[model samples]
Target: MARPFLYRCPITGNNVQGLTSDDAAAEGEKSRLEMVQCLACGGFHLVDPAKGPLPPVDDK
Candidate 1:
């Protein structure tokens, strides 16, 4: 089993459990397990461990 990821919501400070790579891809056509929504403040964020923060992505 893969390790669990940890994420805290900036808006509400509530921690959210992250999804694994396999589980994330199993969400169907609209796979959206990358970032989870904050239960308290309704915010969304990523939980990447390698870079500490979400990596920079460019859409060009």
Candidate 2:
């Protein structure tokens, strides 16, 4: 089942909701980066699930 997660957008600096797939949900809380669509910036941002609700992505 797909689940919702909160992540921070580096571009917009806003908290956004991200939907996870079955594969991701299976991995739950693992230290990995996942690309999430940012509604505020309308772009993609890398989010780490283990980093809590506010995931930070490197701008570099």
Question: Top model by TM-score, which number?
Answer: 2
Question: What tens-digit string does per-residue lDDT give for candidate 2 at 1-60?
Answer: 876888777777778888776564454554677887788899988887556576465668
List the lowest-lDDT window of 10 residues for candidate 2: 21-30
Tell me the deviation in Å of residue 53 in model 1: 10
How many clashing residue pairs are found in candidate 1? 0
TM-score (C-alpha, index-matched) for candidate 2: 0.65
Predict model 1's lDDT versus the native: 0.51
Instruction: Give the candidate number with the greatest lDDT.
Output: 2
| Number of clashes recorded per candidate | 0, 0
Candidate 2: clashing pairs of residues: none
Clashing pairs in 1: none
Provide TM-scores for the models. 0.39, 0.65
TM-score, prediction 1:
0.39
State the C-alpha lDDT per candidate.
Answer: 0.51, 0.73
